[model samples]
Target: MRPLIIFILFYLLCIQVQAKTLQKTVNENTISFDYTWQDHSHKTQTLSFSLPKKLINNKYRRFKRYDKDKAMNHIYKALLEQASSYNPREVRVQFKQQYSQLSYTIKSKSEKKINEVEQKLKQLENKTYLDFLKQHHYIEFNTPWAGTKIKPDHKNFVIEGVDYLEPVTQAIRESISVKKPRVLINFVLSWLQSIPYSTLESRTESSGLGYYPPIRVIAQNIGDCDSKMTLMSAIIKKIYPRLSQSLIYLPQHALIGFQLPTLKTDKYTTINGLHYILAEPVGPAKYPLSEIADSSIGYIDAKSYFHEII
Candidate 1:
């Protein structure tokens, strides 16, 4: 009886473990949607939606803001409609935790149709976002994104508003003196210098990247917190493709992980003997290029930038 019970439990556990697999493949032109949901059994069910670049950030993407089940259903519906146009066999979702990653499957008929629907949804989303952009007309200043003039002499609008551009735009500005990361350092630096700290709100919702460019962060230098973070992150990602999440994310706010070539902040990077440092400039403090790794407030990355309050 004991042997039979053990065998039964083992069989059920195997079925559970095999339910998910690798979610998706990354490419130059791929857009992914990952969200959690509740299955019929009321257990958490995760789904990863990977569609072709035809639709990157579309209207359907906003469903993430709604209820989880609703968002999952919306994505599933779109993928189903898309499958009608092509041939998709399965969709995959990965379950991520502190220690493990597992994936699940969505039976489908066509991959091409999924791409088509995704593109359509992306076009819709872009149109809506663009329309919103057209409605606002002011530059903002908040935190490190501050200091630039709202209406620049050349660009007309600025993000971090300083009267002039800088030699380096990101946290690791000091590193520019020693090494170059293969992209336009000055251009990105100018953007970092252009963030409007004064005009931005203190809070914004985060993206998967742990940054926000909320509506508040946008049009007004505030929107989703992730968008603002993206402004900073985009530069880093452009430079280091395989980098891990920086140790320093924000002041008094715990955010997501991203790639960084150096450990210039209070946060350390376990890479290449720790090559560089940069400040996690978020609020009213000034972080010098040298004191980035200082382990305290008013200092930079040496302290825990992602310390959560709750």
Candidate 2:
């Protein structure tokens, strides 16, 4: 009986030790995990953990240390991967305690569409930028417009504005047999021109200080020069992730430019040794790709400068 009792106690001790080792492993490696949902209200929630090393691994297993920025990126990618499988209504994420006990619910139609666009993007992941442009030039995008009243700060307007993804996706889906890169660009230019022009001053007077989100611009069917350029820029970046692009700012006007294989004009700007063809997005005035407005050309030549979008 004494021997049997000792054996039972030893077994229990082993099991407890195993559990502690597992918990220690988890607590020492994981930094944080995030949960995001896409429904009518776009929402994201993050749970943080303190650990010595980053637990997340890329496909190559290259990243093995915890970096706050890199970890956030990993979490976002993970959420995007999971979100693709859900319908465009309500998306949910739940994490077990062992994994970092977290739950996120996002309700936003626009967010769902964005996830769908991302899924489509995965199909072209292996293709080169030029190849992707050639293959998807004529794909038509069909996403309903959704407007937000929130004002965008300068930084928000430039780098982080993802609301444009949905409409841009829709535009890609709606594209017709556009084989050439120039022709594809024209399609986006035409779409921007179709939106009615509203000046920043006038928009601010009525709606207070805020830039329209790209999706909002589509829903409202009107935008200022900055808003229009922002929307166009977002679309261009989505299509050509590897291309060098920038924002050109004049005294009172803003435009975007892209680096192509060949230069169409000497009137271009160079950033990081890449020449970008200046393209105007604000129009009722028809300007071809790489053609700046005649009035703005001199201003651009004299006082315009470029800001690289990274």
Model 1 lDDT tens row, 263-290: 3333333323443334333322333222
- Among the numbered candidates, top TM-score falls to 2
Q: Which one wins on lDDT? A: 2
Clash number by candidate, in order:
68, 17
lDDT of 2 at 71: 32
Query: Estimated TM-score per prediction?
Result: 0.30, 0.46
| lDDT of candidate model 1 versus the reference | 0.34
| lDDT for 243 (candidate 1) | 47
The per-residue C-alpha lDDT of model 1 at residue 246 equals 41
Candidate 2 weakest lDDT stretch, 10 residues: 137-146
Sequence-dependent TM-score of model 1: 0.30
Task: In model 1, state the lDDT of residue 281.
Answer: 32
